[model samples]
Target chain A: MSPVSTSASRLVYDALKSCGVRLMSALPETWLVHLIGLAEADPDMTLVRLAKEEEGVGISAGAHLAGVKSAMLMQNHGFLASINGIVSCAQLYRIPLLMLVSYRGEFGERDPWQTEGGGVTEDLLRALRIPFARLENPSHVSHRIAKAQTLAHSANKPVALLLCRDLMWEEQT
Target chain B: MRRLDALRAVYSQLEGRIVVTIMGAVAAELQSIGHRPNFFYLQHAMGLASSLGLGIALSRPDRQVVVFDGDGSVLMNLGGLTTLARYRPRNLVHVVFDNESLLSVGGFPTATSTGSDLAGIAAAAGVPRTQTVRSIDEFTHAFDEALAAEDLTTLVAKVEPVGPSAYVTDLSLLENRFQFQRYLKESRTTR
Candidate 1:
């Protein structure tokens, strides 16, 4: 029995690949563990393990400059931490950045520390003017990811897809 | 050595390489020398120049990526050093101009002012090659070697805490980005 939501993780990873995301930068988090593992094992992909989340912003921007499609994978807390980079670098420079954020600490969240960040995630995204969508249903994962990536590139702005608990949790019965 | 003089010493060597300079004196001074399509002056990003360079290096393995950073910016994101070492792109060169102060913002001292050895830190962080130079000759030598070698290198140059008089540039952020992307695309096709 695996701890991660294996089927959902595969769905998200395949969607990213279909969207031509060859490079991914991430910092370790529980919800993103399986996705990160999949990225690491894929030889065709480049996985940059960042020490902090904001670094991924710069990495994605650089990849954009070099004509490589890239994405950033992190938790909601990481998204909050990376707001500075997102605003100052990505937005100011108009880089097309795709961010896949694990929406932790919403409903059914047991961790007290994660709740504050989760609570403010959508509000902050709104404040920043970064359009985002929630991936709560497994059936909507692929289309949402593809749409978000297209929006990012077409609009030349930072767009996010929030991976909700319903789409990223596996219940053991 | 003066920052501008050191830049002049190696300006020609940067002809074909992709250069990413942090926001401040380094970008202004480099632009004053000459602006090229391959040069991306990261205007507002203070501490992510190295990360940007790493991305370009990893994405375009055929091209060499050089980052011009400052003491304050590098100190702000020391974790960047560890990340660079972890991947260790062969075509990446990180050059930190250790003026020991945030010269562009104000004459405030940074961690390097009290003897934080950036080259030593990078070496400890597992970067394959690292060097510290104080003179223009040494800087040029180390930079030339770093660019020529097939391994990741971090070169920290100690200099006086001084910068250009003004921080203005005519190039807009969007314009620079498009020009850079176009340059990369054209160069790839030409090669």
Candidate 2:
């Protein structure tokens, strides 16, 4: 009956816990609001709401160093904004961080501003030499999240799991 | 007061604490004073020293972590202040070297030179204790108080932007991180 008990949030939360992500940082994205709420209500996860996504990157780098597996949940626009922090801190230092990004400005996007960010999301991650996977539906969430976590830990670097529009959007009725 | 002078005094008062130094004069000065595994110097990651320290402080609540920062570095990420306030790690000390210039980057004047008050910013950002000091004596006193406190403290020390002798150090970045982690790990084992 609750908003977050839906298929998408359940799979993501279950995957995050099983992957050993103890801390999470997020900024608001309309599609992610429900998932963010789910994380807030979780007792096992220490969730931090960030003013900017870059701070989440920096904080996650530190948290990773301190032996806590950390993840950053942000919108695609926020991911671009966090490029410098991600490159200079996480990539340069070889700090492992799992980024859970909401894919904005997709085919049905209503905002013009989101087009550029969403269009270049995968390209930017690729340019940065960060490995990533697309999370398109309910079945893809757990496998992709686990793979991203494994890649981050083994390579001592960051990886991205982009939550696609299909899995998040629902009938407006 | 000069930054080097302040560092010498501040370095003397430090004990049983892990230090994280941002790039430039702060890291160079800390290195010139003494090199130890307890000191972690971050290079090329401006505005991240405090965030890194916050992570370690939260992870190892038993140990104190001090960050040697600069005006340029802190301004690069003021949002870190809000995060620090939110986390409120008691064993964290943020010491800002406010010389009002990006001293490491060809001395371009920063907002602090025009009129940016970092101490007021920190206090406004909800840091428990924020102090701005201008003299060597004042800095030593403020830093001492910060080290002794059990809550988050931010000290902004105003000084002349002059580090004529700031140069490269002979330390290894990877080695420093390994040693720092090793020290923390060993400490945990013994406890």
Candidate 3:
């Protein structure tokens, strides 16, 4: 529940804006609450506090169909919850969606529940045939997000920008 | 009233507005009634028609968005209702075809069949407006009010359980999606 730095949120927001993301449907991460706050405060972006990650996928896909570029911000568990909707709606329809997923189980010692999701995240993404790039270092934040958005928009597929443990929370065990 | 009659009644009122229909017989019936470029027929996705409609409505505030959903699909993603209510897009109109059974999947009873009030659930979930219409006249009045108003509304149309509907679509899902987007673009330009 520690407050992640505002800088990380700012960097991601700038990158997403650069990619022409106007609507964001997010399932809040405790470490990324400030990111949601940033999206909410910005007048250019319509922030939807989604009930679940699957709902965000559907909403983002719908927004894309209407010519509005949209993104989803959530943790790995939410990503897992969104698999069916993302695959069925986004993948089947070929709508580009930028998913900013905070990696919960990647690296360092963590909770039991998070361990499984962290371990299986990459495999799950591959199983769904979704292209993804992991951002383990803060330095790659801007370029990686921009690249992910470009690939998603150009290919009309859901691409992932995985924010690993260090980039998510400031303090690590 | 029969599901077909209920759908026909609503379809006449939609005009040029954007429509997203649930999968199975509901979508089949919608296609059978008449096809429009503005209408989106979800082929495989069970519960995301409303979510898609909400997204488009939010993105295109100037355009009215309508969702034609079924009870089984609504039960699958009640959270869509909460999300819709939370965002409260004024241009969104959600109408659920409540046959109380999974008529799309062989008429197995859904929770609604055993007495779950979807309108009450939607209202409890925070949608500004909610109504349940049993007759054609009731549905017409309720839908007209919803279409004319700015607040988000949900109408649960109770219809009799029916057998499998067998209307096949001439176009594919991708074609429908592309055409619908083009229609939205045209709508924006004409506006």
Error of 1 at B37 (Å): 0.6
When sorted by TM-score, best at the front, the candidate numbers are: 1, 3, 2
Clashes of each: 0, 0, 0
Q: Estimated TM-score per prediction?
A: 0.98, 0.94, 0.96
Where is the poorest 10-residue window by lDDT in model 1 chain B? Answer: B102-111
lDDT by residue for model 2 over A8-100, one digit each (tens)? 867887899899988888998876787788888988888878878888877787677667888899998999989988988888778888998
lDDT by residue (B1-191, candidate 2, tens digit) is 99888888877566557788888787787788887777888887788888888878877788888988889999998988998998899999999989999877788999998898999999999999999999999999888888888789999999998885746778867777767777777767877
Residue A158 miss distance in model 2 (angstroms):
0.9
Residue runs of model 3 more than 4 Å from their true location after superposition = A1-3
Per-residue error (Å), model 3, residue B152: 0.8
Which candidate number would show the highest lDDT if scored against the true structure?
1
Candidate 1 TM-score versus the reference? 0.98
Residue B162 displacement (Å), model 3: 1.8
**Cα lDDT for residue B71, model 3?**
91
